[model samples]
Target: MQMGIVRRSVGALLAVIVLLGAVPVGAAEKSAPRHSAQAIGKAERAMQEITAQAARETATAEMQDTRISSVMLHWTPYPAAVRYAVRVLRGSVGAPMKTIATMEYVYTTGLHLPLMAYGAVDDLYWTVQPLGYDGTPLAAASEPCPVREAEADPAAPALTTEYAAMPYAPLYPVYSWVPLAGQKEHEVEVYRREVGHDRYVHTLRGGEYDVYDDTPFTVPGTYVYRVRGVTAAGMPISNWSAYGSFTVAERTPIAALGDSITHGGGAITVPPSYQLYDWESYCTVPVKNLGRSGDTTEAMLERFERDVLPFAPRVLIIMGGVNDYRVGIYGAETVRNLAALREKCRAHGITPIFLTATPIRPALMTARMTINTPPSDWWAHRDYVNNWVMQQEHSIDVATVLSDADGELEEGYTTDGLHPDLTGKKYIGQTVDSYLRTHFAYASAEAERRVRMLKNMEKTS
Candidate 1:
């Protein structure tokens, strides 16, 4: 990990060359500004309210005063906003925020969101990021709008860990947990809740915050895990939290492979930091970011076997093609390269998850470099690759969310249209997270439950 990171300095140098050396395509006509002065002023005021220092979470015997039934994230409506995506946070304003779900529509100035069986009452923070007519985010996200859960629980019981992925294990399955209050030591029970079986497999004792169950899982099928707290005397304390599931196969980490986008980069420099954005910082699953700036599909392939195969990840999210298209590489060649990557993963028994290339804002692209006589129809090429990707299994449709109706990056999501800002990057990360939460659920019971809930929300929304 320490490598470029020194290499990041090297990548930074390469990135500047890519930005300046490359010319943007797709010339456009200017119209009404995407944002107006009035809207910006209102947003500024809303930011002040949302980002204001949060008061200390006062401890109360009742705790009920802090419980909130609903959370509403609000912001000033921008003239260009056709839809708004709201992210809700439950802790401090400045700390990393967990994006629960993205609302599909912007009915009014604000959206009232539901919680995940949130029984605790205290603090919640939200940010509203507007979207263009196309799915692209429209403007800067509203500062973390703080909300309080106005309900109380009987007790502030010790909760479980917010583990990322719970993949299968033949060696030792690692489980992460939060420490239970009032207990210096706690017991954790790991259950083997797979199909055709229902029982506690292991009641681990005196383990660290993260318990690694070394027991060999001889069973070769999908395993769902649920952990519950216990006293040193093997007494139960809190109820079991949500189940974390992973299959028992070639237990490997998940790999995110791509170019600068995968490397977490935003276009433009001088003031904005060039350091790669840590997309996994908020992910629910533990994923290795193997993204490098200025890597085309060919460059990615050159290093694939060496960097990725070593981990033998359970799933590999392969998102490439944009960098290939940047240099006017034929769409077919890019597709061929991606197909090769997919085949390699399949050959190694790795699950392949592909993502469509994100959209580019033409205005930003044009301003970045000299418009060279490149491929006349870059849009067609992009669509061709995206169409092919959509036909495959385990495909992540991020391009749809980032593109405007005109097939360009939504102005709000990018400063240069080729790369995403924090607002855009967060949206992409959360969207991938939503997909993973559903896909990794080997147990259909939990999977179906979430799908049904999303459908209901869609109907009501």
Candidate 2:
């Protein structure tokens, strides 16, 4: 029985060997494929190459996204351009480009856009077409401007305030600067020019890019100012900017006091630093801009003692109430504020000239400023305030030219629908200019009479 079992095991082993092509274990190991050291190294290097290429591609994509987000297109303000048409094109230079994004109504010379808004494109360019009030092309489309990558870090803040010598210097000067990115606040230092040196008078800190110095410049003297950016931790983030100098004197001829409209700057992204956006820029007369960016009628009235008192302007053009009305403040409240402002002007011997508030288009306002939600009764409030203004002895109905048939701000005259752009501002400024020119001799005579009265009183004393 044992012999028979042994024969069966041997037969089974022979059958397995036959199934394995009858190869021996040692022979099978030798016949198997073997890789050379050189070959193995080459395979590993290829994998490293593939990984590096992937990392480079990811870095390029991230850089492109950063560039797209920071894209801001700026152009020279075209003459007679009520508005501009901006088109973003995608293609290589000298290649047939396709317009990917077109903004039909850009009110200012600058336009900020997220290039990613139109999807991924290897090459992008922009062009501007100046448009007339009637939507006619005022000039041919500008040559395509390449969308270059923006700088990683913008330069330090630079002062933008206009300086003048004593006797012509503004008493209530608006201190303004080009704000730095990531700035938590701005530090403004005022120094009075004293005995062959500048004496540090005061230092003020605020979050706003522009400051209406409420501290009255009562003394007529030379003053120097500088600004720097600060971090939230109270640490200085930038070096002191180049000094700005102005001389302070008494009695400004004419000044404008209002909200952002009179403060200058329109078109959502542009700041008041750009002169073209300022209505005062279009005026023939040199009107000092006392208009703060976000002042309501109440705020304007409150600041009168501090801001308007120092200037002692011969004529103060008052345009406000839109900030109050948009937020649903009662028209009566705004009117009361305006009345208070008028009374204060009279008390200080300053002539107060009212400007009818411009109408607003809620749809456009929402599109431009999502945070803004003008009340449903906003127009009613505006009408109430404007009606009161019309009854004032010294008033100009600027709203008449800015409002459409439906009483909304005319699209051609505005970019944000709330603040009037270049065209509307031009109309407002020119109207005021014409009015002032017409009554120039009368105003001059009144000013002279006041001067004579003051001199006589001084002589008697």
Whole-model lDDT per candidate: 0.57, 0.72
Candidate 1 TM-score over all chains jointly: 0.42
Residue-level lDDT of model 2, residues 1-461, one tens digit each, is: 33444455456545544655555667656655663444446545654655565556566666654654435455666655667898889898888999988887765555555554655545777899988655789889988877764322333565655443111333355676655544658888999988778898998886645666656566756678988888776688888888887655455567788988987666554455456667776666666667777789988988887777776788889999989989899999999999999998899888889999889989988876765688999999999999999999899999988989999999888777788887888898888877776766466455445445434543453
The per-residue C-alpha lDDT of model 2 at residue 416 equals 72
Instruction: Give one digit per residue, the lDDT tens place, for model 1 in 40-98.
Output: 46555544443331111122312435345554343443543545676655677657767
* TM-score, per-candidate, Cα-based: 0.42, 0.59
Question: Where in model 1 is the C-alpha error above 4 Å?
Answer: 1-252, 270-276, 369-374, 442-461
Q: Score candidate 2 by lDDT.
A: 0.72
Worst 10 residues of 1 by lDDT: 269-278
Q: Lowest summed lDDT over 10 consecutive residues: which window, candidate 2? A: 162-171
